[model samples]
Target: MTPTDPGQQGPLVEPVPGAPAAVATLHDERALVIADYHAGYEAGLRIERGVDVPSKAESRRERLLSLLERTSVGRLIVCGDLMHSIGDPGGAERGELEVLFESLPSKLSVTLVKGNHDGAIGAWLEGCEIVPGSGTRVADVGVCHGHTWPAREVLESRVVCLGHEHPCVRLEDEVGGSRVEPAWLRGRLEPAAFRGRDEYAGLEWLEGDPARTGSRPVESPAIVVLPAFNELVGGTWINVAGQSFLAPFLPAGIARGEAYLLDGTRLGPYRSV
Candidate 1:
């Protein structure tokens, strides 16, 4: 995590513009938030199959704590998917969770918004508040996990941040093969953009009664989709030509906008964008 300069301002930061990095507002720098941690996911995979993969739970915790230290935040909000199993409890997964739960207090206040993956672990979360997908209001921003888009009221919040698609953008080198890295994508909502897509047909989680209705606007929020913190490494690239998953929102091409590449303590400006 790069320390935010007090004087930076723009619609997007440069280098890896649409990359899935967290942002700090000009007002309060102490409250830092991110999305889609998916802690213990590797352990879940190992249990589902016999494959042995090194546990990443501790490293992920350490990295997040280090990032918090760099950001100097007093609180951390995980938009969703803090756990991987839908409802089953695997031994390795349980151990990973224990490691994470035991390490929180030394860092900062952490909050986990219930995501689709957080099915059973809801009862075990400590030192964190669980918010529904109607989303939670932090300052003026709305935080949600993008497994489902939010309604109009949620979108209208100052900024809607989410994580779920594990969004990444591809960058090709001179030889032509490309590498996909997590990106932070940003764009305002236009009603017409989501009109015809079956994926955007309905909200996955609605707060009130099913019969209760008026015009519920399920717009894609002015979103900042964070990348998966897991090292398993796979994603949908936002910059690819004719890609459908992100086409509804990123039609204009992800690379044409500003980009910032996060390299440890140094965030370099990607001049191409």
Candidate 2:
């Protein structure tokens, strides 16, 4: 639970312009947050898709370092997918992870919310805190990988930051060509969708009255679905017909979700955009 000292201000979550990252301001410290780093993605592409490509590991590390400097955050939170392999990470991936951590400022703390692709990561990575895939609270905000139902405590936050869907949208040009761009999905949580689920069993609402208003059963937290930090990864084309979400509880877990581009362009309703 977040502290409620009358003297301290609440945490604020703000996305970085033109980047797949956000800055979360806590009472005493700020955090740089991102999702789906997918380290060593090039090797995965070669093994799985047979597409040989050059590694962008150094570039990724540099970009993250730049964001850290720009945001001047004291901590870095990776929502999930810090690694690309589902099993043991390859040599390249491990090396990339090592160099990335070594490059960080000595005082900057790191947190990794375990994701589906992060099965093999553990204590070997120094200076990194690995939390459960369900989620964890940082002040008033909840951070999760979004592949499964979040823990009850996480659901109770004022806002929730999630990844794993790698949301994007298909845009069509006047010449009949189409391009896909990374997108952000913003919405409110639906208690009914998660109330009786395993992760949310025995949960109780402390705010709002659904019986009186005929609206949501409880006070819902704002949900922010972040875009993948690695531009090389494929994502769910949210507005395209027949393109479904990857998260198990998404589309149902979120209510009235609207899509936005990385540049902060609101595309209106995701279904109609």
Best by lDDT: 2
Residues 1-273, model 2: lDDT tens digits: 111111234436778888999887766788988999999999999999899999999999999999999989999999999999988988999999999999999999999999999986985667799999888999878999999888778887778898999999999889999999999888777666776567565555534567886877655677889999999998999898888778877888787888888788888889898
Clashes of each: 16, 0
Residue 73 lDDT in model 2?
92
Cα RMSD, each candidate: 8.0, 4.1
State the lDDT of candidate 1 residue by residue for 85-168, as single tens digits: 878657767677687767765656666777787886767666677777546666556777766655444544555666666656
Please give me the total number of clashing residue pairs in predicted model 2: 0
Backbone clash pairs in model 1 (N, Cα, C under 3 Å; residues 3+ apart or in different chains), count: 16
Model 2 Cα displacement at 36 (Å)?
Answer: 0.3
The prediction achieving the highest TM-score against the true structure is: 2
- Candidates' lDDT values, in order? 0.57, 0.85
